[model samples]
Target: MSTDLLQARDLTIRGEGVTIAPFSCSLGPGDRLTLLGETGSGKSLIAQAIMGTLPKGLCAQGRLVIDGEAFDAADSTSRRALWGRRLALLPQEPWHALDPTMRAVSQVAESHRHVAGRDRRAAFQAAWSDLTELGLAEAGSKLPGELSGGMAQRVAFAAASAGGAPIVIADEPTKGLDAPRRDAVVELLARTPEAAGALLTITHDIDVARRLGGEVVILRQGQVVERGPAQQVLTDPQSEYGQRLLAAEPSRWPLPKPLGERQAPVISASGLAKTRGGRELFRDLSLTIVPGEIVGVVGPSGCGKSTLGDMLLGVTRADNGEIDRAQGHTLGFQKLYQDPPAAFSPHWRLSRLLDDLVRRHRLDRAAIPPLMARLGLDENLLGRRPGEISGGELQRFAILRVLLLEPCFLFADEPTSRLDPITQRQTLELLVELARERHCGVMLVSHDPALIERICDKRISLEATPSVAKRELDPVMA
Candidate 1:
């Protein structure tokens, strides 16, 4: 008798000009497997194939077996019956996966009661325990919108695993989390295989694969370039692509150039404070940003990092603060969102959106081609909608959209959290170079402390309590 928890033979995905080559793998009891790749490399496609949730126009062709039940990957609905009972998937973006109107605990409890076949009271208690274990005991009553990116991710994980599924698939589980929270998530993922279940994770973070301590298969352009044990492959990779990817980690990046002489201020904020869900995010925060400078912000998840950016851009009202923008530059203030897909319309093609922006602003259409080339964006990508492209591509397009307006102040809220390491390094380099060339003031927010230390000319560290400290990046580190 075969005791494999999950198996896929010749699993292949095909769409228009793109094809994920035939791949095969299996997971047995107490086994862990991670698919390591960059955005658009077909990592998510393979997970979606097993889950039977491939996007429209893409089709999977392979044989999939989960918990001794076999199905055809081509049939998208074949695996729906196993969802949350024998199979559970934690999606890449928790905000989109979770229901906006439902409270966190209720969502998990519903899964437990319905899928796990537990009674109402028992399910509620189990859900509570899960949240408590994940350090989200107080967040149970909060809605998805009220939680931060990392908190919402934990709630989604709790809901997904409440059914006690033996086969677990997590996609980009630690994409936008701080070091401690990311480690916590890795531990939770490890618990699945530790309890005799099987774990299949799809992530672009090398550290995630290292922590998971699983078998790794590296992909590039939808083809496998390397496969081996985590320890051997991660520490000493045999493939060239894998080496490049590992070298792109922010900690390994070269130090950015030292800050030049100060210039006129672009934006200034004084005594900023915000309270959400009875938690004080920060208080008495004041800072000034000069043109051609990059300011980095670091803090724990849910510490109002995004809120602070919104207040500076005038998107949200501050509880106690006054913001000043350089006169005559009001139209130049813009923002780059954390989630690129959420900021765009799913129904419209990229060309349509770009045309709308250009028309609305009366900007030059001729400049689009040169900018697209510089961003390394292909011309064919313009024909696809926001959902049709990868997160990395959509983010570069977002940068293109903002740069066209010749902005003097840009607030980027965790802009590269979802990007793969190589693409992330490239994107930040371009952003910094452009900012310096145009003399734009950039308020850069990231969860990685090493990233901030390497690139920012100034730094702002926010705390959970009522305090915010702003200072210059130490020249010694450079």
Candidate 2:
């Protein structure tokens, strides 16, 4: 007799050395619930449990009701029939959700055709329309591998929601999006509830939850710390963790100290040009990075921010420009990926991978423990595989690995996008400190302009056209 579209009664999750205590919540028609928390705080796990997609070795318990049908949470397969018909999930990592071999439009069309019960032609048309609305008109024909991280995210969203499920779950839905695109995504999510459907969103961005303006549940270390209306909880959070999370926004962060003196340039490039998908991304770009300096990159999604970094690191060739690295430092250039799990072997434990790197490069084993402590990583996390740990932890681990080689230049591609505000602040502060200490030049990429403004000494702003500009802060500001 309950009118709720979905309900969880004392749902709990268990895994090796981890336990998400009993929690209960529900969503009715036109309802929205957001799980707000730090990385590794069980936000994604809760979403996985609801979607019946928890990774191996993790088990869920308690009762779940979906579309008036009751099922035991432990039997994940019991809800298979409801997938795409009554429930849909947009995973945090779009790469995992999208097929690498399939074109963006085709994947979305598949969902519309099969799950939404539309005809083939109608599905294809709908798919194209979806891509166009998401500002990906040209990306429809590109395979998942060809798209940028933000482009791939939009594709995945189109595919997941094409089914028209009454209940939707989105995890970190706006993680790597710029302000305009991020607002668009939020509008899309808001529309679901407006159309009399139910929505559940998981995110670490406080602004995202505030914009959604629904019920908010704060979790920490696998436990519910607080729950209330979004306006009340976000504006006047009672829990101590909630206040810290809100305070850690980039806008509230303290400005970093200016560099002491200009050092020799670590890398220099001139007249860089690149084109992708038959569109001119950027041309005639030039920049210089000095040791102990942080240069930030900001542009719309798919505007070639990552591509420019690759050009400088020699991972990708520029069509018409030349890159010059400091002499004798060719081996010292490194990169930290946007998705940390993609960079490591999922089957190997973190310790084994670190050991291999140390052995291969003749790095000092003693430096590992201190760096781990400084990064706020627990030693026990090293025992688990990359897929077993949270994204933020893996990213920190990636930084630790890169620092071990004593790199002179680093390309950090949205390194903190997956982290919570508190963790993001902490990680970036540590990265800046280490960059200054080791005199390493870091090119930081981020979707948030405020973040780049706070931490970067210089910034490169890319536009849709071939024009680009590199802004250098004054000595006092830098």
Candidate 3:
């Protein structure tokens, strides 16, 4: 019996007139592998090539064989025939994977109808149950626009698992999710070897590679620089590039320094009660933020963390509550969104946006480079649009945009979740340092308990998740 289920022999891919050196790898039945690299390193490109969806002008050259049949990656007809049976792609960007107009449940059901050949009614039935199990039962009726980054991520996962395709390639599957949610993703992928056949994950998150124990391949500039057992490669890398990559992974954050004398509250709220879509998120919630103090807000998904941030910013009104502000408080509201790319205009060049933000805020232009450098961003990123950059890079840029504003209160929602470990540490450090130096009040809304404990002066947790029956029953009528 042949052990090789899928094999790529000397595959070379070229995009935008640049060539990636010939690379090769194989996956037997029940195999798992990961491709790790930074932005623009051709990790996604390789997946696209394998899925026969490479962008126009990109060339994939070499021999690919699956189940003893030669695979021509450039042939769309052949790919279409194979997809959802022998092959499938779990796209890195959920925003790109899902349809904006359709309800999330319908999209997943669509996956079932197309891949599993289920009848429409059966597909919808299965989809409802599947999404519910993935923690998206309440999100079934939501259009992609209405779902949060994390919510949409779960929707994508449900869709990917619907068909049980034999070969699965998931790209940055856990980028927008919290620890528990992402761990669930890892567990699901870990089981694919038996339920499906092979799993290939593409991510910069070293934790994912570590958790999904299997072969590890490090990609740099489109070349496979290192390949070995996951434990060995991640722990003691042989390649220089691999060593640098391993060194960048973040460890537990250091406890924050001692704080000074207490200050009066900058913003205070009491007896806050909020209900949305006829479902109560939280009730009798109270919190305060004082200058130079960091307040951590945490809870599980659908626990009103982001909603609380909105309420604090005065964008969402509480059904019953009074929020008091200190007299002459000019430093009001600024937000570092979880999905940074979604916040910016895709058509606007980074240069235009950054320049306008800096000049509008009277920020020193010279300080921009050093700030970006601290976050490991390239100055040249300014020339491109938000869609052209990587998620991690876009996140750092988003932080820079807000920091330049120098708001009095910063509602940072999952600010560091999208970042790699090393960059996560640096970004959080810089944000807190500047917040303290400027006497700014910060509310860190996150699901990361460790991070909250490490830096927060006082933590207030909201803990109530309305069931799907209440929220997903009827759309909020106009």
Candidate 4:
């Protein structure tokens, strides 16, 4: 008989007086299981509970057995011993998971030392090979700040897979990755062995689940609403929640009508060029945005989409380019990054941050409460800091703050890249409604084609030019 690698029996967790219902699940050796749910639907909480790191005020009652050994939750020593060696986890946010100050080689090597007892030299050697295998050939020696979102996530995968843990739990491992990179990450995780163990992935992307070939456990609110083969459940779900979750993605929605003749371009770029690391990322690229228009920018990993967005936001300077905006118009930009918590000052409370922005932007105080409510944020949460909230909640607050600015142009870069399906749909709908109401032009940068198709009036794919010397081609669409 095949032995079960991980098993959770009658697991129930409580946080702040709210209880997640009792649930049971098991994973056999070499098995793959997926936990699907909306944002804040107890999926991640379940993973944390299993890891024995449930936050303060949260209580758990369950029997967690891993690799023939029963977990003793009350014993911190035993938990730590088993955490990275016997069982490893890849968190939802790679930016937060990695230490910003440390180099990639050091981080991955540290995992080896803690888990496998490798020496510094051996750890570095192993990390380099692992990173190469994960398609991050030059990832080592670079700090987390230097890597792009996709590259950072790949490094996190390499670290998690090192030391040969018996069980690996990945929460949204593909977050912030483009389509090709997403596929590559999923494929690598599915094929990588974990010291002869099993894999449990928590994600809302049905396509990812199907690619990994896992048994699906759909959670709604705080309970498992359905369980079946990943393909079967995704193709023909039985539960209403499952159906709704599948239907939430706008790619499945009908395409929007094309724009008719417009009076004037809201924003325009000419002869745009950005250079980094002595290399031309993009050259002579130009685009135009009209009022009520949503233009999506998409490309493969390392194609300079974020660089362009940063240039537009005035966060980064372009090597050569001329950008024009309508006079007397403020740029209302809200970016829902792959990791929202990392974007804000951790020392400040949410209320203080919002209040400061409101005061500076001269927004009406009366509009705050209703905006929070519209975004599904509680008014009471204003007092809480970003660390106290989930990623989805923080993203909502960020977007709401931008909405309050009421700028003529909005730049949203991967706003829903880290969100679950339900939250992704809700955020997109909210953006559409707000843009229409304010007559704003939105430039959305994303790697997901489905997202581009859903909300964008037009889409452009950016490619890195062969070199900066070729200026005759005129990369901009003037």
lDDT of each: 0.87, 0.89, 0.77, 0.76
Q: Give the true-structure RMSD of model 3.
A: 6.0
Instruction: Show the lowest summed lDDT stretch of 10 residues, model 2.
Output: 469-478
* Residues 1-478 of candidate 1: C-alpha lDDT, one tens digit per residue: 7899999999999976669999999999999999887768988878889999887778999898899998899998978989998999998878667899999999999999999999999999999999999889999998988787788888999899888899999998887788888899899999999999999998878889999987999999899999999999999999999999899999999988976888989999888888877878777788888898999988877778899888998888999989999889746899998777668988999999999999998999998999898877889889889877776778889989989998999999888887788888988998999999999999999989899877788788876556343323333254
Residue 284 lDDT (model 1): 79
User: Which model is ahead, 2 or 3, in terms of TM-score?
Assistant: 2
What are the models' TM-scores?
0.94, 0.96, 0.84, 0.91
Error of 3 at 350 (Å): 1.8
Candidate 4 clashes between residue pairs 3 or more apart in a chain or in different chains: 286-476
**In model 2, where do residues sit more than 4 Å from their true spots?**
467-478
Candidate 1 segments exceeding 4 Å error: 467-478
Q: How badly does each model clash, as a count of residue pairs?
A: 0, 0, 0, 1
Q: Which candidate is the best by lDDT?
A: 2
Candidates ranked, most accurate by lDDT first: 2, 1, 3, 4
Which digits, one per residue and each the tens of the lDDT, describe model 3 over residues 1-478? 5666678788788655446788787998888989886555677777777788775567788878766678765563566677777777887667877888999999999989988999999999999998877788889999988877788888988887788787888888887677788898888887778664888888878888999978998877667889999999989999997877776554455667755876887778887888876778877777677787888876677667788788888888888888876666454578889878678988888999988877776677887888788777777678777776567778888988887777778899888765655557667888889889977888887766666767777777666564421211111110
User: What does candidate 3 score on TM?
Assistant: 0.84
Kindly report which residue stretches of model 3 are placed more than 4 angstroms away from their true locations once superposed.
1-5, 8-23, 37-42, 52-85, 204-207, 219-226, 234-251, 326-332, 356-366, 464-478
Write model 4 residue lDDT over 319-363, tens digit each, in one string: 898888777675454444545766788888888998888788777
lDDT, candidate 2, residue 468? 50
